[model samples]
Target: MTTNTILFDLDGTLLEMQTEPFVKSYLVEVGRHIGDKYDTEKLLKLIWDATKAMIVNQDADKTNEQVFIEYFTANSEWEREEVWPLFDSFYRDVFPTLSHLTYPSPWAKKIVETAKAQGYRVAVATNPVFPREAIFHRLAWIGMSADDFELVTVYEESHFTKPNPGYFAEICQKLGVQPTECIMIGNHMQEDMVASTLGMKTYLVTNWMEDRGEPQYPVDQRGSLEELYQALTERTGVFAQA
Candidate 1:
């Protein structure tokens, strides 16, 4: 089937940032932001535990944000009422400032625009562990905007996280596209390539590649973001032939 949609992963794929350093910085900044009012270490632990909840989440009724907050409510000193404003403030004022951790991709904008110009539905298919502001700020770092895509997953609405087939399934369901109608593009060998299991075509971006023994899916194409740009704009390779 001809693919009509494209899903791009953020972070290492589009935004140029190593996953480990970026996440460590994020965890530290968030801890320092709200931890002054509470037990800092405990709060950090709570946040991670909540994050893990979102990753393994299976309940369709509960959004990842709800699951994260629920972990805090049930196991921590803070209440939902208290957590929202604190995290919201951090995401708005602090998260955007972390763009220094990620540099812009020279080809990110071109690939996205080429797909859009070709009338393909594009999604910033980043993991939905973070809030909308977090995702938007990261997109801004890569010289794109959340509004540029047909769908941008956020913790407030998403019920699954990366490497889980359910996450891709949820996105497919939301976009009204069959898995065979889309291409999943990213740098991570496992998390991004897992979309292939759902029958979505996979394109593995090599810059800042994360390979942790997830060679299960036979990648349909593999190269740099610039190569992806070529595939779309030049209308060649698996993308054009799909």
Candidate 2:
């Protein structure tokens, strides 16, 4: 059987991120650059608020950028342009340095190449929470590149984020494939595994899985990327071609 697409999540799925350390380092670095202008706790709260708004935002009238900007302006009068440098300086410098908190999973890179060699369309369906540049840097840390994926969800380009069926729908429509023709592999049970509702096959990368209360959907569990590789071929019958 030919599986036309495989959608992978970044962050904890492809890249191993120790949540506390990464966030701590991130807040520290960004705080160092912009803290004096804004209260550190309040700034963090604003970011969380914007993220929550993004999760519940289903309005057809607004993009994520618009939602975030609207929420940002309402919460703090900071100019949008002023915040741009934080992303530029932080992701390029401080973020990369935080790589010490993460490591390349050779298994993850190998799986992508193996799937592509087997004629499956590969995509990084990472939540569109971060900018493309940030995603690109994370991919680089794992010895992958933006060019490795047929589709990569970036905030500016995507209207919907994960856990929302619309996010998966957008990728299907863009790739010209039905949801059933794609498989979503990620570590978040709530966010990534929810793709099954749209009929996409689901796999749990449990290396860094989060306990999301309880699962509302069924998924195949694989402990590591290496196991995922074998499981995908076995379950999809991709190996039968051999």
Candidate 3:
């Protein structure tokens, strides 16, 4: 029998928040900080443009961090070094304050504890878009702390983001586990289900699903955390009879 390792997504999976409201709040606040030079509307558009550029950024010549810095610097009048500190400040202070908009649900916390108790390696496989500080803050909003995870990917440390099979591969490599022994449980069809293509088990957390472009394989899908937790426990031969 294989030892089960559970990989989770952060934003919509563990932490609950309405996407639009959270984005609106984040952009509004970020805009205020940059407004001394750039207009709010323009700043928002620039961010979207930069994000789009990032999605297609596959050049071996530059890393994502470099690409973002280059794009950000090219579009703004601020010096490169100045931009980093400003963005870091916003992420550290203003980002955590957004935690007020998130609510804690018992199921998320319960599942993490159950997985750990069952001797599963529980890692947060959230896309490495934000810094570790931001990731911890969001986890705290859901009543889960860094101590709950065996591994948590942060933007500064990871070179690839999900939907890219390399990201899934890297996680398996780091954990010293085979792809078949791991299970990815996440809300995004494209990001989470990508693991299935690489021979890993996958669970679709439908309650907070995002319609990624498309999924390459069929996966075990569930609508709630309770259902997912039960399925995993049963599969791993760790579920106790009631």
Candidate 4:
């Protein structure tokens, strides 16, 4: 089937960064933002727990934000009205400073432009564990924005998270396309390549490839973002506009 849509993962794929250090930096900054109001360890634990709840959430009625907030507020002493704004402030004011830990791929823009030029829809299928503001800020690090994609998944907007076939299905449904008509591009074999289980073509971008032995699904292609740019340009027969 002709591919009509391309889904790209944000972290480690187009935006280069070591996951562990980046996450630690993020948590530390958030801890600094919270200060003595909450214990850093306890707060981080709650965040992780809420994130896990969002990932496994099967409730189609509730968005991921609702799921996360419901779980987070319930487990913590803070009420939603008082604590939610603090989290938003952290993303808006503090998250941008972490850009030093991530470098953009030279071919990132070209890849998206190529897909658009070839009449394919583009979506950023980043794991929806972050608020839209945080996701947008990360995109800005690469000189891209939410407007660049047909769909950008965020916790507030998504009901399912990555590595879950339902997440891909939700995107396909939103795009009015079949799973086979889409391609998933990312650095993780288990997370991105798992889209193949639903018939989506999978490309493993090895820029920061995770060392997951023996992928559960077939990888249609594998390469660095630059090579991906070249391959996609060739496949789409669409050169970057001068």
Candidate 5:
């Protein structure tokens, strides 16, 4: 099937960064900021538990953010109004500091532009475990913005997370396209490429590769951002003008 929509994973694929270190830094900074009121270890554990709940969530009534918030506050002594603002503040202030761990890819802007110019709808299919504020900040680090994509999945807007074929299906539903009409470009083997299970074409980006195990999905293409740019240009005959 011909591809009309392209879903790009944000962290390691479009924005250059090592996922492990970035995540560690994020957890540490968040823990330190909220340490005075909450036990650092316990708080971190709660965050993970809440995140896992969001991942496996199959509920259509509640969004991933709602699921996380309910799970997080219900299991803790804190109230949502009190704790959520603090988390938002950390994302606004402390999260930007983590940008030093990431750099903008030279081909990032070109790739998105080329896809759009070639008549493909673009969306950021980053894991929806993060709030919109955090996702927006990360996009800024790469010199992009939420305005760059047709749709951007955030915790508040998504019901499922990556590695779940349902997540891709939900996105396709939102985009009003068939799964076969969408192409997923991401770095992780398990998380991103699993979109293939739903018939969406997959591209395994190797710039900051995350290998989980032997490949279980078919990748229609694989390469660095620069290589992807060239491939897209050749295939779509859409190039950025000087």
Candidate 6:
């Protein structure tokens, strides 16, 4: 299929970062900000566990936010009334400070802009484990706005996370495109490349690849972000059809 749509992963794909350290800082900082009456360690653990719950969630009706908040408040001393403000304030205030841990790719903005200029549809298909506010914050680091892409997936509006075919399917349905008519571009071997199961073409970004020592993944193409930028601009290799 000649794909007209492209899916870009945010974390290590577009916004460069060491995933483990960034996640640690993200959870620890949130704990520090909201652990006034709660145990800091326990609060971090609660967030970590609830995050996993959100990632594996498959409820079509309940958003990931519903699953995360329900699981988080149920296991902790916090009530719904107490949950909203603490987390909301943390995202608004503390989350943006963590941008220092990430290095934005100059090619990321260029690639999306080039794709738009060429009339190819684009979407930020990052794993919706974070709220839209946090996702937008990261997009800002990459010099992108939500208006730049046809769809931007976020926890509040998404039902599934990456590596689950449902997540890719949900995006396809929303964009009114077939899975075969889209390209999944990301750095994670299993999580991002899993979009291939839904018949989407896959591009593995190896510069900051996160394979977790798993068996080799068979993707349609593999390269760095700069190579991807060139592919979009010159219309070569896997992007030749575009």
| Candidate 1 TM-score over all chains jointly | 0.95
Clashing residue pairs, candidate 4? none
Mind sharing the TM-score for model 6?
0.95
lDDT of 1 by residue, 159-192 (tens): 9999899999999999999999999999998899
- Candidate 3 residues lying further than 4 Å off, grouped into runs, are 1-3, 59-63, 233-242
Q: What TM-score, over all chains together, does every model reach?
A: 0.95, 0.90, 0.86, 0.94, 0.94, 0.95
lDDT by residue (73-127, candidate 3, tens digit) is 7887657675567678988878888877776688888888878887789999987
lDDT of 6 by residue, 119-181 (tens): 789999999999999999999998888998889999999999977889999999999999999
* lDDT tens readout by residue for model 5, 12-85: 99998899998888898998889788788987899999999998988888899899989998898777887888
Task: Tell me each candidate's RMSD, in Å, in order.
Answer: 1.4, 2.4, 3.2, 3.0, 3.0, 1.4
lDDT string, candidate 4, 25-77, tens digits:
89888888999987878988999899899989998888999999899988998
TM-score-best of 5 and 6: 6
How many clashes in candidate 5?
Answer: 0
Candidate 4 lDDT trough over 10 residues, lowest sum: 233-242
> For model 4, what is the error of residue 60's alpha carbon versus the real structure, in angstroms, after optimal superposition?
1.7
lDDT for model 5 comes to 0.87
Which sequence of candidate numbers ranks them by TM-score, best first?
6, 1, 5, 4, 2, 3
Clash count list over all predictions: 0, 0, 0, 0, 0, 0
Give the poorly placed runs of model 6, Cα more than 4 Å off.
Answer: none
lDDT of each: 0.88, 0.78, 0.74, 0.86, 0.87, 0.88
Which residue runs of candidate 2 sit more than 4 Å off their true CA positions? 232-242
